[model samples]
Target: MNADLSRLANYLNPDKKKLAAKGITSVRSRVANLTELLPGITHEQVCQAVTEAFFAHYGERVDAEVISPDKTPDLPNFAETFARQSSWEWNFGQAPAFSHLLDERFTWGGVELHFDVEKGVITRAQAFTDSLNPAPLEALAERLQGCCTARINYRKRAKRC
Candidate 1:
């Protein structure tokens, strides 16, 4: 189903070739599904909702270059995302205000994931042991799509279930 990410992703890039190459062809409706869950909402409404959420989450406190959902596979989960977005390095890495190095070490599911974000971008990264080091990141990327259910229409739930 099309949710917010897929809806906006399709709107931003209508041609299927790039999406196919990146193996993300089905995201369009995924975005649609998210907003449609809210009664009377169209796909466009979902995009606006997510964008508003994004801005609300990161406004005033930081200068975000682009709030685009991570299209890359293996998006990070909420904890990882909260950490990433809340970090001083990720938030001010690109700012002229200050420059500093960020270091963190954590283990999840028997694997250690090490990451550093500088200048609002990932600068250093490494994964130890398990291969799902990327899942957290992918989960984070898909956050926008997951956002759709936040305001789903109560009646629609009965109809679908």
Candidate 2:
């Protein structure tokens, strides 16, 4: 399926929230049915139809925000995060094996991240903050894990962070 259709399916499915709250096994049955149903209608025409239907049902709830460029959040300290790591051979193969250990401190937000990466994938991530509520930092760290550094669209993702 195309990226747009995949995104639409994810947006349409209420099971995403359920999957996050409940475990994968808890939603396995429904997911199987959904998987069976999705492919038949993933074509461009069906995607358009589904999009129209979705907007018809839920258009009132959709809010499009227009934030000014000057108000954008500062980009995370990726350079410092990547630089602190000590590289090593992860495995014996023709592919270059490397690992990175990253510890970054954000001066403005008082947020810190300790990330362990192997073969360009974050294997472990931990976040720390002086604030009593660390939810946002923790959430950010969780989202960073398994993210390919080269593939990340920093400008797009920074706004959410």
Candidate 3:
């Protein structure tokens, strides 16, 4: 979670705000509480007035945002997969990547990842773990074979970036 927060902090800041139609007197402090508060309605959603707040907070501070972690909201599946931390191991693990060179690490309880591509597949890869089964990573690589539109699957995320 800390890693995810820090990653988001690179892109978000909380102290910035654009004033509404009101004059300079209400630049930071808006005229009246600009957000609409409901009566007995606990429905949670940011009023879009606090985009700065979203940028201000990175991880746990997201709890303070109207958006709840329980809901996936606008995050992509792979990103959400990386964000939620089930334990300290998940939160503190190293980020693996294959750039000009294949980069990975062996940490305590790190899951070994294997990649494979076939059927005009240009990439074949494997990893051995002293842990559980390896079918899922294999399947994921297979799913990307037809869609290898980029150099690698992680590269798709870079497109969005």
Instruction: Report backbone clashes per prediction.
Output: 26, 0, 2
Top model number, lDDT: 2
Off by over 4 Å in 3: 1-5, 8-109, 112-122, 125-127, 149-161
lDDT of 1: 0.48
RMSD of 2: 19.7
lDDT measured at residue 104 in model 3 versus the true structure, 0 to 100: 45
| CA displacement after TM-score superposition, residue 22 of candidate 3 (Å) | 46
- Residue 41: error of model 2 in Å? 59
Clashing pairs in 3: 13-56, 14-56
lDDT for predicted candidate 2 compared with the true structure: 0.56
* Candidate 1 lDDT by residue in tens digits, 64-110: 34443453235468557866887665665554422233233446435
Worst 10 residues of 3 by lDDT: 27-36
Q: Highest TM-score: give the candidate number.
A: 2
Poorly placed runs, candidate 1 (over 4 Å): 1-7, 10-26, 33-35, 38-87, 94-161
Q: What order do candidates take by TM-score, descending? A: 2, 3, 1
User: Considering TM-score, which of the candidate structures 2 and 3 is the better prediction for this target?
Assistant: 2
Local distance difference test scores for all models: 0.48, 0.56, 0.41
Q: Which ten residues in a row have the lowest lDDT in candidate 1?
A: 141-150
* Candidate 2 residue-wise lDDT at 73: 35
